[model samples]
Target: MRRALVLTDESARHPFRASLPPHVVRRANEVERMVPWRLKLGLTRKEAESVLATYAAGFVCTLAYFS
Candidate 1:
C-alpha cells in the first residue's frame, strides 16, 4: 500500500539541497492552488515508492521557495 502525506517546502527543500542527514526525494511541479508539504521516512523502497506515488498525484511539485 502507498502512504500519502503533506509536506512544506522548507522541509522538502532541505534534503534536496543535502541539508538533511536522511534521504529525501522531491518532484518539481507548478500548482494553481496553494498546498503545503511535509517530510516522511520509509524503512524500505516499497514504503518510499508508496510515498512517491502519493506525492506525484496529491501535490504539485515545484521549485518555488517561500521563506
Candidate 2:
C-alpha cells in the first residue's frame, strides 16, 4: 500500500521524461537517493512538510551564500 502510494506520487510529480531539464532531473534523483527510504515512507504529512521546508531553506541559504 505504502509502496503504491509512493510510486503514484512520484509518477504524478514527473509525468514525462522531459518534464524537467536533464541536470535538474539528475540532481533531484541524486537527492532522493540520499534520503532514508524508510523515513520517507513513514513520515506524517506535517513532518514531511517540515522536512521539505527545511531543505528549501537550506537551499536558499546556500544560494544566498554563493551570490
Candidate 3:
C-alpha cells in the first residue's frame, strides 16, 4: 500500500494529509499489512468478528500514538 501511495501522487496530496502526519499514515499502513487476509477468508463468523476487533484495535493504537 505504501508503494501504491507513492505511485498515486493525487492521493498523497489529499487535504487529510495536512492533518495526519506522514509518520502516522505510515504506521497505520504497517498495521494494515499485519492483518491475515488468507486466514480471514477461512474464518467462521465468530472468528471473523474477533479478527475484526483485533484489526480495529491495531488501527486505534496507531492513531493513539499520535495523541
TM-score of each: 0.26, 0.40, 0.37
Superior by lDDT: candidate 1 or candidate 3: 3
lDDT (CA) per prediction? 0.50, 0.67, 0.69
Give lDDT tens digits, candidate 3, residues 1-67: 3533333234456766545656777776664546677575777779888988999999999999999
Please give the TM-score that candidate 3 achieves against the real structure: 0.37
The best candidate in terms of TM-score: 2
Model 2: pairs clashing at backbone N, Cα or C within 3 Å: none
Report RMSD (Å) for each prediction in the order shown.
Answer: 23.2, 17.8, 16.8
Q: Rank the candidates by TM-score, best first.
A: 2, 3, 1
- Across residues 1-67, which tens digit of lDDT does each residue of candidate 2 receive? 3532222234436566445455566676664347776576997779888999999999999999999
The residue pairs found clashing in candidate 1 are 6-37, 6-38, 7-37, 7-38, 8-37, 8-38, 28-61, 29-61, 29-62
Give the candidate order by descending lDDT: 3, 2, 1
- Residue-level lDDT tens digits of model 1 in 1-67: 9855534456455544444333333333335564333333324667678888988765554423321
- Stretches off by above 4 angstroms in model 2 are 1-40
